[model samples]
Target chain A: MVVKVYGPDYGSTKGVLLCLIEKEVEFETVHVDGFKGEHKQPEYLKMQPFGLFPVVQDGDYVLYESRAILRYFAEKYKNQGTDLLGKTVEDRGLVEQWLDVEAHNFTPPIYSLVKIYFASVLEGVPADPKAIKENEEKIEKYLDIYEKRLSQTKYLAGDFFSLADLNHLPFTSYLMNEMEKGFMVRERKHVSAWWDDISSRPSWKKVLQDYKNPYDVLKEMNLVN
Target chain B: MVVKVYGPDYGSTKGVLLCLIEKEVEFETVHVDGFKGEHKQPEYLKMQPFGLFPVVQDGDYVLYESRAILRYFAEKYKNQGTDLLGKTVEDRGLVEQWLDVEAHNFTPPIYSLVKIYFASVLEGVPADPKAIKENEEKIEKYLDIYEKRLSQTKYLAGDFFSLADLNHLPFTSYLMNEMEKGFMVRERKHVSAWWDDISSRPSWKKVLQDYKNPYDVLKEMNLVN
Candidate 1:
């Protein structure tokens, strides 16, 4: 049976799609329209109580949380495609460490920036300049740490492109392109190179081509500026 | 060689200690006092650039981030003690899913509350009732989800106690006892029972007896409250 992933094509869902593609897993996407608040409906709530994006259904088993889904496919398909978890126990440790770093440190500040930046455009709420500046500084501090780590190793979790690197694709893509914060990546030599390396993977390229971000769709429709 | 865990016996460090005890891993503590700004010092930052609690050094390998360390020990000692990653791929997926849930959804609001609740007591900074109310409400929402989850399974991941449950020990302990927010857990039937089960573990008991939280230490010192 093919893996069924439910949610939109953008955000963390893109990360899930990218992992499935890399793992060479047979899967189909079921769109949950966030704009219509379909995820908050009772049926969707049964699968994901929090009504979040990108819940995966594989046979009798069901799972939510994109990072968890990424780990699942990576472990399940360990031999088939890109080696995500890494080779040694130590390597896996670093992967888990960096994954936490991404979740706790990197994601929060950048995500805050994303919400603040997009709220003005999407919701007509004026973005707070102070909050934006604070978030940007936090992002820069974290990127500095990333720069140091990337200098020592080719990727965040060592030389391999594990889930640690893959997890950054969705938001960092926004930071680099859509959010016009590319300089945040470009300013740091090692982080810049690392971003280029991970973002250019064929799997991510396929996800980019196949899954149009709803925000971009809105842009094309002239509904969002 | 015994693992060398640096940083104080508080917050995340307690979680690491609990995992080590559960796994029956020999480990020694090396304190980096956060109260004295020791964690931010150069020597400590070399091991953990973010200057967070609980940096573990086993032999030549150095690892930080408490949850990552919990995972490292759990995977390394999979056969020795509690099966934290879960028995199968699907179980492991649920374990990872809830772990992310704890890190992403649960930790943020509760941590914010902790800071707000303690700031006035420890630093003589007036607490913001509005922020406290918002965080408490957010935490209650997440706990409702946990109540639903625990009703179906013995633990957050499944029937067995996994990292998902263990990871909640530290902050939840703070919430239940130190912060005097036990009502939050006690009000939810399944969540209350789950908390009682996990918090009563001998390993956690040992951690509690062995390591004292810095804030509590300060209180003893007539430094805080």
Candidate 2:
């Protein structure tokens, strides 16, 4: 099946691309630059009302939200490739549970850590030390929980490497590489091992090779004013 | 089948209760007061390591996160009552897409608005107008999208009321009733109509009639400090 993905090259976009690759899906891309207001235009809004991306259109059926799109692809092509969800109902529950953890728990703190500390520098604003300190404590607490979970099981859902683990790649990669917080992952042995396992997956490697870093583009444009 | 849910009488907790009621599933609850740190105890952490709740234990299996618990109960009891997910692959995808919207898009801004204003008052701090103004704008934009979508379909996922629609109940009710922002929902005609239709469901009405508000308990106990 042919799929059309609309988004700029960003962290959220990589998650969908990685899902597509894992499923061995063929797809074309239509880049919609947020800075250019392309994503906010009426046409893009028709497909993705939230004005975020990447949105996937397989013929007339369209879906958005990176994790939701990943899930749609995984469920649609469950038999064609590696099963990323799980094999049983309980496993499915665990997978959904951890995915919710990633969305509701893991993401917000790390994102604030990034925005308050690093992205603010990109925008030529002084970093808020108090904000950074508070967010660091929050992120540390979240990762401590991750460490315990990873120590108990090989992956977030369980022994299997599921979407629960895969969903963390994009943001964690940004934290380790761009934000230079490798210690955040590395200090926790189980989390580090878990990261090493998932990040080394062929699909994730493909995501690394194919997807461009938005931060690098922002740097090149020298848009910090 | 008997299910036991562990959580306080908060918004997230009600989402699971509503789901169970909708599915015609029998469940009992053990209230875990967040103000008392009961949720963070070793016993509660064993069932839900994240220390947040609406965790449901059915026989031997346990699940957490209100939405995940809802999905588990819905799937396990799909044949017993109303189907809360969807019938086909496309429908399931749609349901998931909107569920993510509620999780990632709709919930965050509303929660932030609550924390910034009312919850801050609980901490003896004046509400920051700047943060409130920003978050209110964000909430407005998100609700506009919801309005447009509800105008097109009878519910978030489609004409049928699914978990996606049900998930909005707890937070929307809090915003409308507790926060006195009923105007936010009432202002958009289609959204207002959709709310009227879904909130009128016997299941949701029961949730309102039975579940106690955490804020009320906190007020009674003078625990806000």
Best-fitting candidate, measured by lDDT? 1
- Candidate 2: regions farther than 4 A off: A222-225, B116-121, B222-225
lDDT of 1 by residue, A1-225 (tens): 999999988988998999999999999999898878999999999999999998999998999999999999999999998999999889999999998898888888878887876677678899998999999899999999999989999999988899999989998998888878999899999999998899889999999998888677678769777
Q: Which stretches of candidate 1 lie over 4 Å from their true place?
A: B223-225
In candidate 2, residue B114 scores what lDDT? 72
Which candidate achieves the best DockQ against the true structure?
Answer: 1
**lDDT of each prediction vs. the true structure?**
0.90, 0.84
Per-residue lDDT of candidate 1, residues B141-220 (tens digit)? 99999998889999999999999888899899888988789999999999999998999999999888888975677788
DockQ of each: 0.90, 0.72
Tens digit per residue, CA lDDT, model 2, A1-225: 589999987767887888788888999878898768898899998889878878999999988888778888889899977788899888988999988898888877777876675456555678888887877787788999999988889999999978888888888898888778899889999999999999999998877887777676667777542
Model 1, clash count? 0
Residue A65 shift from truth in candidate 2, angstroms? 1.2
